[model samples]
Target: MFEIGDKIVYPMHGAGTIKAIEEKELAGQTQEYYVINMKIGDMQVMIPASKIVSSCIRPITDIRALKQLIHNFHHGESDEVLPWKQRYKVNSEKIKTGEIQDCAEVVRDLLRMNKEKTLNSSEKKMLDHAYKFLNSELESIKGITDNQIKSFS
Candidate 1:
């Protein structure tokens, strides 16, 4: 269970702060929902505790875990080039699943490609989204600004 002011990762939505906990009557029963305010935008979402796991609401990764992710992002790369359509399809799936590790994989793959040449609009947007998601979590855990994190990268 998350309390107000706690940071959580909402699949596809990235990192959000728990703004409030509220109870509402629905279907003749009272249920509680966590009100999450997105860090990157003016969006607020309500998630029921009963469905938290399925919704992929989870605590941010700890420092060690985050370091592992960074290491993987830095080291994991494929020399074989894949067709753009296939790469887009696979990366889209990873982004949709809202798994942090999967997002890291997408960032790593795109960064590798970028080193070789420019990316298409869609690929650039995906890379930006992944960077936003990871950077938010990194900022929260490291007590630094996203810009600072970007500077080091």
Candidate 2:
């Protein structure tokens, strides 16, 4: 039941604002869809209204929660004990969860690993995407600044 103008994050897709909701006919049926204006690529995604719940599209986290996330990030330990293949598998699953905390953990662990040793192409690309995805959602939060977002690393 998100309304137009609501800010939401779609798993793996980053954050966006709900631009419109429209109904269109196809195959003699009219299905409603939410038109989202994505921040990262300046693109639009039309999600079926009925599928919103199952799609994992969710509202952006509040500023207080983001501050708490940053606090945990600073205090939490990186979990890169798993071998590269396993580590990649775990990180991929975390990104798929679409939870801000999980995404932040992936970014933190990957950034630390990248500093210690060059990550393989796969991990490198995942870091870039997850970083952007996390940042986009953070940016959607009101009264947040670029400096605060950079502290995640």
The model with the greatest TM-score is 2
Candidate 2: misplaced stretches above 4 Å? Answer: none
Q: What is the TM-score of each candidate against the true structure?
A: 0.84, 0.96
Considering summed lDDT, which 10 consecutive residues are worst modelled in model 2? 71-80
Top model by lDDT, which number? 2
Model 2 TM-score, all chains together: 0.96
Q: Residue 128's C-alpha lDDT in candidate 2?
A: 95
Q: Write the per-residue lDDT of candidate 2 for residues 1-153, one digit (tens) a residue.
A: 999999999998999999999998879999999999999889999999999999999999998897789987777899948999999999999999899999999998998888889999999999999999999998889988888988976
lDDT of 1 by residue, 1-153 (tens): 778998888877788889999998899999999899887676899888788888878887666676567667677665367788888888888877777788778877888789889999989998898878766666667455465356325
Clash totals, every prediction? 0, 0
Kindly provide the TM-score of model 1 when superposed on the true structure, using C-alpha atoms: 0.84
